[model samples]
Target: MMLIDGKKVSTDLKNELKTRVEELKAKAGCVPGLTVIIVGEDPASQVYVRNKAKSCKETGMNSTVIELPAETSQKELLGKIEALNQDPDVHGILVQQPLPSHIEEYAVTMAIDPSKDVDGFHPENVGQMVLGNLDKCFISCTPFGILELLRRYDIETRGKHCVVVGRSNIVGKPMANLMLQKLRETNCTVTVCHSATQNMPELTRQADILIAAIGRANFITREMVKPGAVVIDVGINRIEDPSRKSGFRLAGDVDFDNVAKMTSAITPVPGGVGPMTIAMLLKNTLQSFARSHNL
Candidate 1:
């Protein structure tokens, strides 16, 4: 089985975006800018924001990370979002998830301007995406990244069976919606399985393309995968590994070793969907910039 090298694909996309940003700067006298707001000191959130900021700089885009204390109130955060919404320099705005328990996550998601919602969590954008108005709204990065990988690799999705194993708004839901779009590269019969799914294996084994986003490590085993199917592992779970200095290693939903032997292609964790998500975020930010300036 061949590995779907997302690291390479994402890098190639970034290189293209870097060049576009340069041309945009030359024509519009400004580059696309992304602002990330972090509410707490969650280690994983910090790492994600840092990587996003670093990527923005690498792609020749402007970036700012607003570090807020854990005690920041909902009104205070919403006020900051409103200010960024009106800022012409900021083309994309993203608030890192898992806010303090006292804060309302839904309120924060709705506060951002839909046009600048690069994370694509705003209700307006989500509705537009569900209606297949892709050019008019931002799509969540992970799902967009998955479609990009499939298009780049020339994997056929038309008239195929796509099984998405998850139901979260972030990944699974958007993924199923995108795959079922009546677009050129999309248009698949999608089946979404979650905690309530019955006969999961029987359903999964029928997929031509299987996407695992259930957030469990090594959850999709060989028996659950169909031979020659394309598997996209979106779950990144850290399992304890005594051999590693960090005391853990990253794994995806699919049991890679065993699943790889059965599938025609598979995406590995850490190097797979992770990189693509960042790449798509950059692309979306650039698109937002272009739209704002009529470029």
Candidate 2:
């Protein structure tokens, strides 16, 4: 079985973007600027924000991080978003997820201008994506990254059966839509299974390409996958591993050890979808920058 090396793929994409960013900088006399807002002190969110900032510097882009206290009011956060929205220097704006219980996530999403919403959670961008208007839409990063991986690998999707296990807005939903788009290398019959799905294994066994995004560890077993199928595991869960120094190991939804034996290709947990998400986020930020400058 071939391992889908997301780390290598993401590095290649970032290198390509770095070169383009230099060209844009030389021509426009400015680099792309991205602003990330994080509310509360969620450890995972903090780490993600730090990585994003590092990537911006690597690509010769400008980045800013705004950290608000856990008790910051909704109005206060919205006011900050509005300020960034009007800032010409800031092209992309992202607010990390899982805000404090007191804050309304939907309200925060709507406050950001669609053009600056690099996270692609805004209503306008999501609507545009659903209609297949790629020209104006910024797709959710993880789904966009998955498509890039498939495209780069030259996988055949036309008229094939694509099964997506999970229905979360972030990965599963957008992924299904992207697979169904009538574009080059992406027209497929898409099936989505969620928590309520019955005979789930039956549906999965028919897939030419299987996407596993359910938030559970080792959820997709070998029997559920078709032989020679391409598996994309989008779930990341921490499970106890006493053998490791950290005492926990990261695992994807698919049981990689057993499932890989059944599939022709598959993505591993840590190095699979994680790096791609960041790469796509950087790409979206650059796209937002280009649009801001009318380039």
Most lDDT-accurate candidate? 1
State the lDDT of candidate 1 residue by residue for 1-295, as single tens digits: 8789999999999999999999999999989999999998999999999999999999999999999999999999999999999999999999998899999999999999999999999999999999989999999999999999898888888999999999999999999999999976689999999999999999999999999999999999999989999999999999999999999999999899888988887899979899999999999999999999999
Candidate 1, residue 179: Cα displacement in angstroms equals: 0.5
The C-alpha stretches of model 2 lying farther than 4 A from their native spots are none
What's the CA error at residue 230 for candidate 2, in Å?
A: 0.6
Question: How does model 1 score by TM-score?
Answer: 0.99
Q: How accurate is candidate 1 locally (lDDT)?
A: 0.95
Q: Give Cα distance to truth, residue 187, candidate 2, Å.
A: 0.5
Off by over 4 Å in 1: none
For candidate 1, the per-residue lDDT at 177 reads 96
| Count of clashes in candidate 1 | 0
Which residue pairs in candidate 2 collide?
none
lDDT of 2 by residue, 214-265 (tens): 9989999999999999999999999999999989999999999898987888
